[model samples]
Target: MSHFGFENDIHSVLKLDMPITNAPMARWQRKASTSTSAHTGALSPSKSANRSLSLSKTPSKTPGKNGKTQSTPSNAGGDRFIPVRNAKQMDVASFLLSKENEPAEESTSAQANQQANQKAWSVTLNGYDLEEAKILHLGGKPLNAPEGYQNNLKVLYSQVPTPVSMKKSRYISSAPERILDAPELRNDFYLNLMDWGRQNLLAVALSEQVYLWDAAQGDITLLKKMEEENSYICSVSWSKDGNFLAIGTSTCKVELWDVQYQKRLRCMDSHTTRVSCLSWNDHVLSSGARSGLIHQHDVRVAEHHTCTLRGHTQEVCGLAWSPDGRYLASGGNDNTVNVWSGAQQTGVHCFTEHEGAVKALAWCPWQSSILATGGGTSDRHIRLWNVNSGSCITAWDTQSQVSSLVFAPNYKELVSGHGFAHDQVSIWKYPSLAKVTDLQGHEGRVLNLSLSPDGSTVASLSADETLRLWKCFEKDPSKKAKPAGASSSIIQQHIR
Candidate 1:
C-alpha cells in the first residue's frame, strides 16, 4: 500500500527551481540609481570617500566630525546600504555568485536528509529479509546516527526479529490424533461435525444427512438422513448428553433427531425465515433466524415451539446458550445483542454498541453471565458484556472481521475466526484478552468453530470444504496459561 507520498520502496523526487541571486549587479544598480542624489548631498567627493573609509573601519561606532557625533540621515528608500570599502580585497562579485548557488546545494542536502529520515523510519514485518528491507524505530537518536553507526547496530532489532521460513518448519504427516471423517456417508463435502455422547464418538452433519463414526472401531455408519419438506439444512447441534440432535434449515424449520433410535422425534415450523444459527441446552433448542427472531423449541414437546424471543430489528446471525441454561444471547445485522430468558418477549438486556453487523456470539462456559460478541466490520473487535447490567465490560481488537467465536470449554481462552484475513483462527485469553496463538491451515472463510469437551482440541469448519482439528497447547498447566510470545503455525500435511 502507498503511504506518505511513497510508492512501494521508491519516492518520486520533487524538483524546485529558484532564481539565482545577482547581489553584485544589484549593488551596482543601486549605486547608479542613487548616484545623482549622492552627488547633490552635503558631503563632497573627498568627504564622501573619507566618510566611506571611516564607516568601513568603525562599522559599530558612528563617525564623528570635530570630536562631535553626527547622526547619519536615512536614504529616501528608508534603508541604509553599507558600501564595500575594498571591493578588490574580497571578491565581492564572486562572493555574491557563491551565495546565489548555496541554496541549491542546501536544498540537495535537505533532500538527502529527508531520504535518510524515511529510510530510518521505514517499517518491515521481518517475515522475509529482502535486500532493500529497512527496520523501523519508534523514537531515538540512534536512528539518526551517522551512517557508520547505523550499519553496525540495528535499532529496535528485537522488535523486528527475523521469521523462520516455511521450508524450515518440518511438515510431518501422520494420522490425526482425532479424526471426524467417516466412511459410510457419501462425504461429498463436510459441513459441520461434533463429538457428543458419553463415548464422544464423532457425529457429523452434512448437507442432507448426519453420520456417526466410531473412532475406536474405525467404523462409519449413517446416523440419520433428515427428511424435511423443501428444507436444506444449514446448521446442527447435539444435546449435552448427545442423546438428541437439533437440526436447522433454510426453510426456518428445526427438527429434533433421536440419535439412539435413528429417527425424527419432532419437527418445528416457528421461524419465518432461514435459520442462521442453532444451539441446544438440554431439552431447550434455540434457533435464530434471518427474520431476527429467536425461537426456543421444547424437545420434550413434539408438536410446536415453546416460545419466541424478539428484540433485534434485523436478521439474526448468531446465537449462544449460557452454560447454566438461564439466558440465551443472540446477535444480528442490527448490530444489537439481545439476551433472552424464559418465555419473555422483551429481552432482559440489549447491547448495541457495535458499528456493523454482529456475526457471532459466545457465552463463556466458566463464567455463566459473561457473553462475548464479534461483529462483521473492518474494526474487527470482540466485545464482552455483563449480561445483568447490559454494559460492555471490555473489547479486544483483531486484524480481521470475526465470523465465528467459541470459548474454551475451560473458559480460560476465547477463539475467533475471520473470513477476510485468511482462514486463520486466533485464540485469546479471557478478561485480559491477550492473544495466545493463531492457527493457520484453512484457505477459506471459517464459518463455524467449537471447542472439544475436554478443552484439549478445537474444530473449525471452513468454506474450503474441509474440517480442521487443532490441538491446544497450554504451556502452563496450573493457570491454563500460554507462552509469552508463542504463535501457531499451519500443519500443511493433512492427517491420514
Candidate 2:
C-alpha cells in the first residue's frame, strides 16, 4: 500500500534481505546571505624626478695619482661640441599634442620588424577558434553547454581513432609443440645442462654427451662426446654470437668448441671441483664450480683465466649475466644469491632470504636492473630483485620447488619450472605474480629451462628424460623474422 511496503514486497520477491529504515529524505537549504564587503581605493602613481627640470648632468671624474686633481677625460667619442641656436620655449603638453596631430608614416622595415618581434597570443586548434567555454570542456562538457563549446569536443571525438588492433589473447597449447627424448639427462638441480643459443640451436647435455638440435633444420647433431671414464658434461653455454660453445665438465675443465667448424678450440682448466653452471658475457665466459668459486675466462686470449669470484661458500649452481653485461648473478647451494659487479672477486649484494639452495637465476632482458631468482624445495620462492638497489622488490611462494626461471622477452611474464608436487612449468604474469597457466606434462622434475633466440619458444628439460619445446610466447605477426644464419654472419665478421 505504501511506497516502503511496495519496495519491501519487491525485495522479498527478488529474495534480497536488505534492512529497510524509515529515514527522512534529504532537502536543499539556502545559506544566509551577508553584505560583507571591503572598501578599496584607486592607486596613485609614485612621484618621479622630471627629466626637464634637471637636464644638466655632472661630469664624471677619474681617480688622480696621489690624490692630486687632474682634468677629467672627455667620454664623447667625436667632437664634443653642439651649435647653440635660439629656440622658442614650448609647453610639454602642447608639444605632445602637436606630435600626436602629425600625419603618421610607418616605415616598411619598422613595420616588418615590429611584426617579427611580436608573438601570436592566440592558438588555432583544428581550424576552430577555441573560446573559454570550449577550453573548459576539453575534458568533458555538460548537456546544456553552448553550441561553440562542442566544436573542440566534436573535433576531439569526430576523428576515427586509430583502430587499436586488439591483440587476440594468445592461445597457449596445453600440449607441447615438439617432444624429444633426452635420455640420461641428469636430475641434478645444481647442474645447468641445457642452453638455447642465439643461432637458433638448442644444446642439451646428457651425461657424457652433449647434443645440439637446430630449430631451423630440425636436425640433431652430436656436438661433443667425452672419452674419459669419469668425466661428464655438467653444464653448457653458448657465446653471444652463438658460434662457440662452452662446456663445463665434471673433471673441472671448461672446453670451448667452435660450433661452425666442429672443432675443439681450447680447454681452460681453473675450477678445482666440477663446474656446475656457465654463463657468457660477450667474450668473457663465467664458469661456476662446486668448490664455491667462479672463474672468469677471457676466451679470446691465450691467457684464458682472467679472474676468480669468491663469495659462495658451497657449490655455485646458477650463473646468469645481465643483458647489458654490467652485473653477473650467481646462486649457490648455500641458500644465497650473490650479485657480482662485472668480473669482481666478491659479490656486491648477497641475498640470504632463501632457506633452500638458490639455483635458478634469470635477468630481465627488457629491464636491465631487474634480476629474478628462484629457491629450491625448502624455500620454493621466486624473488624479483632490483639489482641497482641491492634489495628484493617482491617474492612469491611457488609451493613447488623452482628449478629454473626465464622471462619472456616479448611479454611482461615469467616462466618458471618446478620440481616436486607437480613437475609443471608455470607461466606467471610479472609485477603482479598472478599465475597465468601451468604447463603440466613432465613426469619428473623440470630441471632446466631455456628461451629461444626469437623469444617465442621455451625448451624445457625434465628429469623424466624428455626435452619439450613449448610455443608459449608467440611472435607478433607484424614483425619480420631475422634472416637465416645471421649469427653466423656475426661470427664471420668477428673472425674477419
Candidate 3:
C-alpha cells in the first residue's frame, strides 16, 4: 500500500474485488454447484459422501505443481485442459491437426509417381498409342533404372513391348473399296450372284432394280429392272451350285431367279411378313421373316411349300445350314439362336446368352459342326458354338455391330463387317478367337462379305455402292526358301 498507494486508493474508491469484475465468478459458482449436485445423484451414497468430505477438506486457494493458484478461468467455457510437459505427448486438438495434414502429402506423392510411370512405359498400336488403348495398371511400383544398366535390365526391357502386334499379312482381305456412293438406297441390301461363273454373273435385288454385272469383262451393267414400287430387297443368297438365286424382298416373298435362262424361276408364297434373311444348301432353301417364321423349301422337288420348323419369337435375322446338311441354325431379334434337326423335327438346341439380337450366322467350312454368330444393336461380339453340345466355344468383342460375317475357306480365320462404318473388316484367328487385324478403307456400311473359292481373295459389297476386292497372302515366303546343295564333285571325290 505504501509503494502503490495511488493505485490502491483508486481501487478502494472503485470498491472492485481483486481489481476485476465478479459477475462471471458468480455464474461459474452456480454452474459448479449444479454439476456437483448432478454427479452426487449419479454416484452411490457412500461414494458421494466420501467425495463431499474430501472437497470440504481441500483449501480454496491451493497452489498446483506449476506454483499457480488452481483456479479455473471464469470464461474458459467448456474447453478441457491437458498438461503435457514433454512436447511429444499429443492432445486431441494437436492429434486431429496432424491427421488433417497427412493425406494431402501422400496424395501429391502418388500423383507424381503415376505421371512418371505413364511417361516411361508408353506404347503404340495400329497408329494409336498406349493411352488410346486404355491400358490399366493393376498393382506395381514404377520401374526406374539408370542409363546403360544392363545387368538385369535387358529381361525387363524385353517384356516392355506393346501387347498388340500389327502386321500387313494379318490384314483382312474382304474390306470394301469405294466404287459408288448412292444414298438413294435407304437400306444397304446384300448382293448375291445367280451364277458365279464368268459369263452369266448376275447381281440381284438392287435398290430400284436387279443389277447384272458383267463378270467376263469386269463391268457392271444393269441386266433387268424391277421398280422399287413398294418394299426393298433385304437379303440375297445363291444356291450351292449357283444355279438359283434366292431373293428376300421387303414383302417377304422368296423370289427365285434361274441364272441359266435369265428369267424368274418361281415365287414361293410362304412367309407371312417381310423376309429379312435367306440361306440355301444344295437342295434345301430356308428363308426367315420379320414375323419370326423359318420356312424351309425343298427346292429338289417342284412343289415348294413351307416345312414346319418354327421356334423363333421375333424377327428372324440369320439362318444357316450345317455343311453335312444335318442341322439348321436360326437367329432372331428375340436374342435367341436355335438349332433344329432330327427325323420328325424333334431335336432342338437353343442359345440365349447374347445381350442383343443375333443378326448373322455362319457354319465353319472345315468343322461343319461348329457354328459362329454375330449381331446385336452394335454387333460388338462374335460367338462360336459347338452345335452338337449347344455350348459356346469362344467369343470375340469387336468395335462395332457385326452386320455380316463369313468364315475363311481354310477355316483359319473369320471376316466380319460392321453396319455403319464402311471400309472396315475384323479378322479373327480361329480356335483361339483372337483378333488378328482390322481392315480399314470402306466409305459405307459393308452389307455383304464373301471368300473366294481358292481362299486367295475376298470380296465385299458396301452401302457406298461398290464391290471391293481384297487379296489374301497367308503363305509365308520364308518357309519356301531353299539352301544350296552340297557339290556333287566333292561327294564323288570323298567316295573315291
TM-score winner between 2 and 3, please give it: 2
lDDT (CA) per prediction: 0.65, 0.79, 0.64
lDDT for 131 in candidate 1 is 28
Q: By lDDT, who's the top model here?
A: 2
Counting clashing residue pairs in each candidate, in order, gives 0, 0, 7
Error of 2 at 94 (Å): 99
Per-residue lDDT tens digits of candidate 3, residues 8-39?
88778788455565445654455545557776
Taking all chains together, the TM-score of candidate 3 against the true structure is: 0.58
Model 2 C-alpha lDDT versus the unseen true structure = 0.79
Candidate 2 steric clashes: 0
Those runs of model 3 whose alpha carbons end farther than 4 Å from true positions after fitting are: 1-184, 188-204, 214-216, 221-224, 420-423, 473-496
Q: Write the per-residue lDDT of candidate 2 for residues 1-496, one digit (tens) a residue.
A: 6999999888787764655455443221111011111224532323112321222233355457798666665655322566444434346657777766665563555577765544223233334334433534455543432221323343333223332322332456677777888877777888999999999998999989998888888777888999999678999999999999999999999999999989999999888899999999988899999999999989889999989888889999999999999899999999999898994455789899999999899899889999999999999999999988888888999999999999997676899999987899999877767777889888999999999998988988999888888887866744433424433121100000
Error of 2 at 186 (Å): 1.7
Q: Model 2 TM-score?
A: 0.63
